[model samples]
Target: MEIDSKDGIERKLNMAQQSDFNDPVISEHNIYVCHVPVNSAFYRVIFPTSKINPYTNKWLKARFKKAVRMLEMRLPQDADSASFDAKKAKYIASQQQSTSKTSFVMDRLLAYEDIFIGQSHSFDAAFEYAISNIYLCPMMGSFEMRHLQAGLQNLQCDEAIHADTDSEFTESESETDDDPSPLRVRFVRPENEFQKKRREESVTLRNKVAEHSSWISLDLEKSTMKSASAKLNSLFSLPNPVDSLLKLRDAEHLVEETIVGNKLAELNLEDRHSLISFKEVRRLPDALQLKALFIKVGVISMQHIEELISFKIEHNLLISRIREYAHLVRGVWVIKSELAFPEDEYSLQRIVRDFALCLLNANLPVRRSDMQLAFGLTVEDFDFSLTTFGEHITSGERTWRLRIDGDETFGKTKEDLRVLIEEKRYWNRRWEEIHHYLSTIKNKSDFTVQKTFKRSFSY
Candidate 1:
């Protein structure tokens, strides 16, 4: 048997050094940027293997010098080997307790053990010290929560490191498996009651979201026709014959005559009593008067009629509004009519205001479905078309925000809004004036008809 010599071991060490440069082991020892939230102050570095000893005594000298450098500022150079070994072991053992809950302390300890081995000059001794002295504290949180907290902590560490480079080693500088940051720093906080509750709620919400997002065949089939129909309605449309024949005076007047006669016949004593109970009996003639007036105006579109109904319902005057509705139903069917599509200007403005309120309340860009839910509405229930809404609201990745610039709140205020408000008021006043004129003409017609009937019946 031949005894391994110093020269042989030195040659092997040199060859290993050269081989390491070209080996794939460099990739396995990946440099990871670590963060610990426990301390919220520092990051630690982690090494791969802790084997610093060689087969011969010649390797001992080089190993000792490097060990001295690692522990140089903390320990004296003249410190005895045994004392240095004890201190190094204690340091690493203390570090293990500081690691994140999901982080493997043993792997990190093994990497640091190599440096400690240089001081102890014994692989077995350092390995034994590491295993016996390093303590891994029990984690009190769920594994995923621990991991998520650790990841957030790491990001904070990364940001802190960038702001100040005093702990530059913590940031990843190489592609090696060795963690570039300090592994001894505590990156995570212990779970408290508040945090536990929050995590539980978060988990529950996530599960609910997952369930909601799942594709159920029934739901898909149910929505399929509705979505198709909506698309079809938007893509194709037919003009109402009522709108086209509004220019023919005799045809339109005949239709109005039939509506008024039917409404007068439907107004039974019981219906009139019900209207009186609601304090709306007085508005019955106004409804008839408005309908006759609208027929004569010719320019008053069917959408304007629908708006009148909506306006009456909104003001709790539905009993009065239904009189006008009665006439509209007859005219639409007799003329084979569909109401013309209304301009979205006012409706779109209202919807956009709702979106702005949503953002203000949430303080973040919310999903469209979430906004709709807040309003107790389905996605399809928005007053304006989605295509029109898209023009005003700023859309994000699956989210939407209000374009608040030059608005009264949420962004810079400007004079343009006031001008817009004035324009709206001006149009409203003009519309009121036209309605008043129509009402005056209808009152005169009713008086003339009553007087002519009285004269014809004189005996």
Candidate 2:
């Protein structure tokens, strides 16, 4: 299908007509394809519509390239064909309601947690970590378990002490029934059993440290403890107790790291697959099924949102960014077009930079071609201009590099001009001046008088 260059968006083909195979006649613009009745297309592709700002056409082009790359990668769980099919089916059937490729991928990952979460490949290191770490005491190892048991015992002791104190107070009140003054209460606090146990463990750990002198001391004859009770032997070893402890600690840490690392690797693999799957992704049923799973699991993070939207800048945000670019382009055009013919190249370059980069924060660097495209300028518009914005010396035969002394033509340096432009009050007064001048000219008949007044005003 043809699109008129004049208006880029106008469809030249009849929408009712279809190709011989009954496929929709896909209309191609500069870098995007728009299928008629987009929702039912093989894959829903976002195209630049009349509603989208012209300045954002570049962004759409970039998104199209990213989406294509996403369509090329393979899924992570390619081997488990049966399981994959079953999971997909269950996801589809269970949805009365629910959403997106990203959501589907995340749900599958959650369901198959064993692939990413359970076992550590580095068993020796992880086991060593578990045995030695003080923090892992509550969860594992003989010494740490003993410490936890002691803590519980301490809690029980505190409750018993409170009960005894209450009983004594009751007895004393009964013996002196008529005494109105509150009975002086002084009960000795017991030594904390948890602290005592901790101190004992600390002393033992310190004593073990003394035996080793260094943390890296390993038993050279590893064959001595090669039994099912190897772990028990490590716990009771007198010399270099810390070595055994550190190994246990390392094992525990390794387990945790392995779980997290494996999960991340699988997730990354799946995410890559999701990108590829985007090409054939069917909406409605599949999206709804995934959404349902996400809702069921209450997975409502920004990452989930990003996954759903394919991490492209959202429409509103894109429009906002584009609007800033367009405004800068418009402001520059307005300022330049009103100036006298044969303005200095340095001044134009400075003004364009100040308008486009400093104020707008353009996503891409401002270039001559971009500036031309932004305003749809023709060769005639630049007839009197020396360069796209200003003159710059050509580097070798290939590149245009601005010379150090390129701005010698201007009264002020680029930095000085930028500072002046950045002042809010300066722009406000300029805006008011322009407003007053524009307010005076109601029709073409007033232009002659207005031009005279404007020349005198010297803006």
Candidate 3:
């Protein structure tokens, strides 16, 4: 096979002639880059695969040669095949586990198996792993819990596999179709207590989600016409709005296929990349539509939020400040309305009572940005130094009182946020001031100022 390196191309070289290649092309035009780690005794050579002995035979032995010059060769002349395979295996094992949980795995579990079965087995496993490995592991009390029904189903599958294997090896039974071969073996139901409990839990949970889901649907449809205009602006939009929507609608069906090769190449997920790139990924309809739906889904269910609840929200804007995080709530339902209520949101009972009032006033289908208006906040009117807005969190409750200095323990939340939505009033501002000084820049564009910001979402 011909070879190429970062240095230059080398033609028709056998494995030994080329000692090492930072990059090499092997038999069938596969190309690889080898990296020799700093402060290490050995190095790795990578190359394209060969049809006949693509990655096989003498090609690998050449990889074993320690010296730099000999390592560059395409093939090694004297090495035995067995030794190369063993070393190659050793080398490969040193690599971090790169085997992906395949789309096949997700497909086999979700599509091939029963719906609940996949969620119970693979879905839960992946979810648990993500929580434990990525998030919750350090906490002392954290423990992984399994759904009892899922556990039982898995236990049953294992037993079935064993029974089938044993029946095949049976000496006495000779299968004959005429008499139906004695039909079958006795079935033993799973006896595990956890399994029984999980099964019952699964049925209960399914019913709950189904009931809630139905309620959500009915509510959203009722509100759709009223709120449809605001929601659709974000949903049906196209960079080239006329053509992009049709392309996006087709994308919903190909989620799995579209995400495969293009995942990390995705600029939006990595914040270090320019925000312009973030806008580009949003052009993908699956992500944009999903986000649009999710935001609306919560709007439809706002009544479900209890007045004294605090919801950690999405739509956070990250500016330069080290610890400051900003969240924008598009719409929230107010439980009650009053001509005049307490000026602050600090009191537990008061914030819920007041915020609920605002929700009631917002009418159906509040613009997410409009939710800020429900609070009746102004930077000039409110004192922000003391409480900053924490008192406004309903904690676990939905209604929160924005804290004023009088109830100084709680802080100005919606009040502080008012600065964001108020149309920029400083007439004296320079072009550079808008460009750099506005740390939380969302609503500006050279051609047409982007009126709003959208978060790319995936569930």
Candidate 4:
């Protein structure tokens, strides 16, 4: 095996030379072994020999010798030897068994295993011993909470006495109170001198921040100063004449423009007219005035007029004049002329047809009852209107929808329509069979036919 040092130096060592070095009692040197290649004779070692103590140098040399010996022993003379293969398999099995055993022990320790220390009888004593052992070494600094918890649970307190007396506890009390107290496990260790000094410095910084916050609050309440300028003044406590001149020059454009651009594209003519009228009035009319206007119009309800007055007062805008000409009747708004029917029957029928068509155009599949109420038509008049618009509309089970081409598909594709038609044909064939059965059994009572029909329906 070859050893490479940090000072760009390399040295080769044979088995005899490697075995010559003695093991050291105390070593501080860091050594690393490179990965071994499959079926290789020798391995590589990377070690830094420069500035290393005599003990570390001796320790590294001993480690290298041991590694070389292990590699040489594991190396087989022949590649296809059955004995070597068996040895390799045995070694692998032994390693796996060791790993599984270590894991099992770790799981047991993490659960509730008995941990005993020399002359220690209580969990607290055992835990303290473990903690002291960890910190006793100068090299060890801290331990984790999980490790502490597992250790505490695994601690054996078989010889523990009651806290109130020196007498040994009974078996039941020992069993019930054997578990360690989680309250005793602290995440943070006690602060040392250095940490105490840092904490004091942090307190001073916190006080300064609090003082600055108070100053900021006082400044906000008492001063009308601009934020950027106030911050700059607070930081520097001086103003530059050249910077002031530049700021004044920039402030010249800060004045708002007097002549606003036209917004004709955004506002329609009717809206523009309303805006102009509102601008001329500059105020909303009184509620009594609005109520009188609504009464004269004879359309809006008293509550609706109050709502409109409130809206106008909030927005300070005039209501549109288009709706003033219409009158509300049965929750629907209609023109004044539409309230009266024509004296001639033909003209009245035409009006009803036109009204029904308008309703159908707005919302498809208008119900017949809704049409009658909306058009103020009797059954005869509604039938006549339907005849008039027969070509344009079709009747459903209880509603009327406009007759559009391909509407039988009901917004479905050709494939979906085909499936629907097949289902319809199946039902139609069953109905035909029922009809033929009924015809053949005409000599029987009507009750028999009804019973057969009900049975077929159930089937």
Tell me the TM-score of each prediction against the true structure: 0.14, 0.14, 0.16, 0.14
Taking the tens digit of each residue's C-alpha lDDT, what string does model 1 give over 217-255? 111112247875664343223334586577456764455
Q: For residue 226, what is the lDDT in candidate 4?
A: 80
Alpha carbon deviation, residue 274, candidate 3 (Å): 18
Alpha carbon deviation, residue 411, candidate 2 (Å)? 54
The positional error of residue 401 in candidate 2, measured at the CA in angstroms, is 16
Native-to-model Cα distance after best TM-score fit, residue 426 in candidate 3, in Å? 43
Mind giving the per-residue lDDT tens digits that candidate 4 earns over 1-459?
455554547866554445565554342322232222222222222222323222222111121112112110111122233322332233333333433344654433322211111111112211112322311111111211111112222334333222332222233234445554667635477878998899899989865654453111111111344864554244323335577576563432332221122331243322212232221122233523442333233233323444444244421132223233333222222233222222354565645554444444345455667766544568776775554223323434566543322223221555434444553454355446545644554546566989999999999
Can you rank all candidates by lDDT, best first? 4, 1, 2, 3
- Cα deviation at 441, candidate 2, in Å, is 22
Measured on C-alpha atoms, candidate 3 has an lDDT of 0.30
lDDT of 2 by residue, 46-84 (tens): 222323232222111111111111111111232244333
lDDT of 3 at 386: 12
Best model number under lDDT: 4
Per-residue CA lDDT of model 3 for 23-114, tens digit only, reads 55443432333222222222122333322242443222112111111222222222233322322222223342435466864422222111
Clashing pairs in 4: none
Q: How many residue pairs clash in each candidate?
A: 20, 24, 42, 0
